[model samples]
Target: MEEILSQNEIDVLLSAITSGEMDAEELKKEEEEKKIRVYDFKRALRFSKDQIRSISRIHENYARMLTTFLSSQLRTYVHIGVESVDQVPYEEFIRSISSLTVLNIYSMSPLKGSMVIEINPNVAYALLDRILGGKGTSVTKTESLTEIEKILLNQIFEKATGTLKEAWSSLVDVSPVLEEFEENPQFIQMVAPNDTVVVVSMSAEIGEASGMINLCIPHTLLEPIIPKLSAHYWMDNTTDERDEEAFQKLSSNLQTTKVDVQAILGETRITINEFLKLGINDVVSLEQQIGDPLTLTINQEPKFYVQPGQLKKKIAVQILEEIEKGVNTHE
Candidate 1:
């Protein structure tokens, strides 16, 4: 039964269908859901200055000195960036991150190009050489970088995780993982966005050679880790516990008062020739007398006159009288 409907009937049917459901409330709910932030697990690599400095110390005992060397060698400055669901622009992110008192971002590049950090060629070569324990001048040809050279650079950064763990202890467990972007689709996708990339560049001086170090981070790859890094810097629970324990142990110990004693009585001068010529039998005269109220010093201070005596089996001193006048004078 195939019956054709008239135009009026079709119109009426369409109108009825349209009027049957008014989803204004559902549309509003959908809009609100869209407004909610969707957290991505990939954005967990963003680290703070404290976290980076702590990590940097793992590479060298002198973190600040190393940083200065890096700056001088690289001829560039380090930068940090943060991105949220708000889609912060690259320049804005650089400005915000560089505003941190410690790191200084010299120049921020535009977000139009591929998410790659730009480092000075000379600095890169110097850094690579230094990391490899080779002379900075050893790197001659840029095209001569072998597969092993690339691997070494990667290893240097990867080893930084171990350094950070040792310094910070169990507060943070950060491991640098290198995934080949060419083969991994996820890696490429992670860096596809314009606002996702953060660049950290620094010029470092390694002896006579000056070089640079540049790091690139995708915004979505670091945002989640920011809180953890911040917590590691500000709320170090383990250190606080250790400090408290040390304080408790120190406070429980008994306290003792110490007495200080000192005295400058008198001085005498004699000729060197006379001293050398003196024989064991010869008598040497001193300004002090044998029994002219021998100075009785209590704690090295002249307090009373005392006479020497023998009491039972031991020699003793008897306080004749207290010297209440000016400094005791001797002939």
Candidate 2:
């Protein structure tokens, strides 16, 4: 039942309209222009656009590293690239992928909670086929992966974590340890249904088979380092002097790495017949003369000029000069 307008209200409305105090069309236009945005609390955005962009850049590097690693391991042309990075509800992420796909739940230590790496069934099977002595071809199988197949898949995920670590090293040093594997998404409850998760969707093409790889990183696990996931913070931390401890650690590790060094007397081009007819103690004339400095190469790159000599009754080469770039090593 509509209540009738009182005489005073009617008189004011009519007077306002007639006296040009209030325009009826203007009031209607104002009402029509007002907008109301519906906000869903379940899908609240926890990460800002800056943070999302930083995460996208980090995973872009991850795709390149994973592509190289997968190509070498699978012995096939594997192309992986970042398709989209978005923040969505945990339940939405879980429901977006296959029902019986491969879910690798892993822990990023020094940061609380666990994350997920969801692999599409087709891509997973193609990788499994390649590893199991078959061509890299995907098969549509409904049954869950067998025990042996799971073992092989686990190994692949474990090695892939190394690339993950390197990719995140620029933002945060994280050790991604695979905790468990699950076939059913509902069985795994690492994050709440309402919790926000940043999902890095990557398009992967291994040989002829193609699929997606979703990396669901929970907000809780990244809360501590959320500040680091900003363009400003990333730019500020780009200098080497900011991370002196890491630099020192890298220097110490490099000290222990062994590199091959060869002191070459000289180089000379010879025909296949000359190489084939060469015998032991054959005096193949070199391009260098006696008392001339030798080229000391490290890891196949000419780096130094040295003089051959005897030290403590053993053959040795004394460093004479450092080889500059574009210098002729034969001279």
Candidate 3:
């Protein structure tokens, strides 16, 4: 199968080299300089760089929201921020994490497939400890979570799904729900090993504990709304004018909302025996004098002082003044 150069052909090459028409060093350098880039078909890129950047922006907002939620719920200082967003093969994503960790398989409705939220064991244990009235610290090692730990984690992440929904609201209205839980990453089979996924890596610091939280969104799950992830779509919808309009609409609806209002004439404490012996015609003394102002309450909150009076033969209470601000008038 090898073709060898004839003596006359080789002699021609030597003549060309000797005549300065060809340089042997230049030929060798040219062969060495040829660049060959390898492309693997299985690890193909499914998301464009622009789309990846958009996803990163969405998760950045998610990180801030999660930080606030966690800090408030745990009553500790929590900081979370987006570390990176990358598109890689599903198998590579799964292999990068620990074998034993918290895997929350959740579904984003209106999308066909499910997504995953992988929590490092340290972070999970830290949160669990904080929730159970301990300092936010984790053990040096980790193991599979118990049934009670799983239930608490479920509740925590179930509430966290709200932040995910809000983050994607600018692109699409997605209701994410926790569907299943697994400790081993290999047990997750939402997508094929060769499938492409966009992973959002976040660095979370909760009190004394710090670790990474990863959100793996398979390409198939985003394929349906891929067009909405464009920069143009995001820019057009997330305008200040749209937000102002929504705010005005909400304000208008609230202005017309009805609330319960009650007027309290006075209060008096009576013995159980006296209360049982009271009759319809008997008069009982109240704490307030005859001309004392009555308290007006709205939605069970004491909000104003009023005067009990009569208008057109109907008893009514007229608002005298508002209760002092920032003071608990309920007492």
Candidate 4:
């Protein structure tokens, strides 16, 4: 029999189609999930959230490495930190540095252009004094730095670059090659004047002396590596590798556990009366051949058969074969 829907049912169908409620609700749900994060192009939105997170983590590592490196180099306790990671116009970054500063121009390969790292003159002079065998002290603002001081500063910046290389190793291999050294900010231009840059501002403190650091990484140079700069990309690719590494470490630790080992040369049975009447030099024969290998046990389990030997001045055993449970090869 053919069944027909009631008029009320037909009206309900028409109402839903007219209102577009069914698909509209589903479409709204999917779109809402996709649009959760709000992005702003005004702040130079070249770096996504994941990219920012990765950059921050990497820079923290750099701060720690630089802290240890400088502390050891200057023979004193030093502290360095990543204060902020931000994006701004190259001009703004240029304007932020002091008139007298140490600017390190460097390049990262596979990247288009160069970057800048600025160290406060106070910190530079402090490092120079320490390197020259003087007590690290806060230096007064000087009108100018000499050519010799510039040369010494070059070596210091080189160490900073080395630390940056190590910090980026887990994410990607990078080599920071120095391009130039400049004291005047106006004369330095690694990229266009108004281009966007990722500026990593940091702070350094040694004893009572303290100063700031700034790194200007141009956006154009970092554009090519956008896909690799995200958090999800690394977490997905390295999870299994981390698990394997942890497992290997655990297994290696287990290999170092101590075990008690002893060898049984032979076995013998004696009567109680004979035991009581035994003398100091009394001879008792054991159920073993003169040249037979001894059974070695580890933690109460028979593990190997070995022959008695003398190694230098110590008694030792040469392993003849591995022993299995309930199996006697010699017999």
Candidate 5:
């Protein structure tokens, strides 16, 4: 009787344990079913050092070319300043640049009372005089110009901005905002307050009259727009494979040539009369004198200078020294 009772108790306990295990498994399945699923995807943009260098080069070239095209009498200097070089992530900024604002400073007082774009009074007068068709020398010694002078100055700024917008539209969306801060201390303070500034100074000489255009761009104003600038200016995807391949082939051909001749050596022009007058018996003088080492030209460029020599029956030239002329020039 005792053995029978013990067997029955063990069977009951085994059944209960199996039931608990099933219940726990079901609970786990239910919990898993209730759980929410999530998926994450991320994209990043990056700029290489070479890319940055290329972008800088492009901007520099654009500035120089624009100045040349404008035929500005004044020397123009374009300065770019980045305040937080490494603070922002490059990828996001490269994709979100939208618009650009350019501020031009015409003139400032000589006394350094505040930290703002400085322009000479004379420069402002000269600019106004030119636009007004008045003599630049006839500027009156006054703090303020006439109402018509102010209007003309404003027009000049508007025209300049419009021209720049047209020029830069293909590269980036640029909008010019011209502000004149002559005597308004508050306007000056509001615009430029310890901000990273880019100043482009353009000095022009219109006949005897000389003038300057000072462009000041504050860093704070430009900070939010940096990403836009990077996206618009830095991320260029217009490379042509055919053009690249052709360039590589040309480069290879150039590299294989033992000597490079340039046009500079043959750039010296001589009149037809000078050539026709020359006679085989007559001593025709050349720029190079006798005893002076003769320059060996390959591809019309002076590669080396050699004294005439003989190799058995054949005439030859012994290379005396490599031409010390500049890479861009012929011997």
Candidate 6:
């Protein structure tokens, strides 16, 4: 039930207002504080810092994966690292792209609308030239990409999108595909001007040259899965395994895993013609002393020095020394 103000209380309020005892600005501030948040319909709230941090962690792994994969594609030593993960307006995202660059709007299945991915022109040209057996130099001048350059970009894009999907597998299953290539980003209308989008900016370096790449994801698309992107989700995941029986089964299987090892005696070099002429009883001379220790190789790697012996009528190699090179799992 609501209580009505007494006449005396109403008189006191009127006296305070008339005597200039109550400031108008203070009253207005009090009213504003009482109201709920004032939301702007133009820009939607999507990601928090924690959520952004979680996404940044995922892209950090993506950068590592791409470093290896991109290195193979470019046939050089390339490194990729996440520079930032932040949310900005769609207009701002468009303004950040270069005038003439390799920026593609792509579709990620099971998510609404599309996303933007931009690669600096320097990186693109450097890769194109390197793939064709040229030095990967910094070419600042913007020239129309040739047909061969476009084919090369397509191959790189395909592999890059695959690596991105692999990176997102931890949070969610997504299939990212390049839908449109934009030479001029101003005319595109992927989202509303004031809409917010999450930007994942990454930096790549190959030898002396370096460049930036970006992924602009719409805020609305990520709003659906914001919970999964929370920092708590990532922090709790390591200790959240509840299936003890399943874990025990995995541990047991790993303990019982079997691996093959090879014991090598000696090596000899001979021509194909000489090798074919030799008979079964013929002895091949090796460049090794008769009592010298033999080498044992595992997984095509020399790991140990052993001596040939017969243990209970079975031919074997006794361990004489362990090599400290390569992956020394035996030690």
Best candidate (score: TM-score): 6
Q: TM-score for every candidate vs. truth? A: 0.35, 0.68, 0.66, 0.62, 0.36, 0.69
- Backbone clashes per model, in order? 27, 0, 0, 0, 8, 0
In TM-score terms, candidate 2 sits at 0.68
Provide the RMSD of all predictions against the true structure, rounded to 1 decimal: 18.2, 8.7, 13.2, 14.4, 17.9, 9.2
Q: Which candidate number maximizes lDDT?
A: 2
* lDDT (tens digit, per residue) of candidate 3 on 1-331: 9789999999999999999999999999887878656789888998888889889988999999999889888999899999999888999999999999989998899888999999988899999999999899987555577899899989999998989999888788998999999999888888889999999999988878999999999999999888988888877776646578888999999999999999987889999999999998999998987766888999998899899889999999898778987874445
Q: For model 3, which pairs clash?
A: none
Write the residue-wise lDDT of candidate 5 on 173-218 in tens digits: 5554454535332223433232234443445443245444333434
* lDDT accuracy of residue 7 in candidate 1: 100
Better model by TM-score: candidate 2 vs candidate 6: 6
- Model 6, 222-243: lDDT tens digits are 8778889876787787778579
* Candidate 1 Cα misplacement greater than 4 A, ranges: 1-120, 127-134, 138-140, 164-172, 180-189, 225-242, 246-331
- Where model 6 places Cα greater than 4 Å from the true spot, the runs are 1-45, 240-295, 300-308, 312-315, 320-331
3 or 6: which has the higher TM-score? Answer: 6
Off by over 4 Å in 5: 1-119, 134-140, 167-171, 177-186, 225-331
Q: How accurate is candidate 5 locally (lDDT)?
A: 0.46
Q: What is the C-alpha lDDT of each candidate?
A: 0.47, 0.91, 0.89, 0.84, 0.46, 0.83
What TM-score does candidate 1 reach? 0.35
Q: Using lDDT, rank the candidates from best to worst.
A: 2, 3, 4, 6, 1, 5
Worst 10 residues of 3 by lDDT: 234-243
Ranking by TM-score: 6, 2, 3, 4, 5, 1
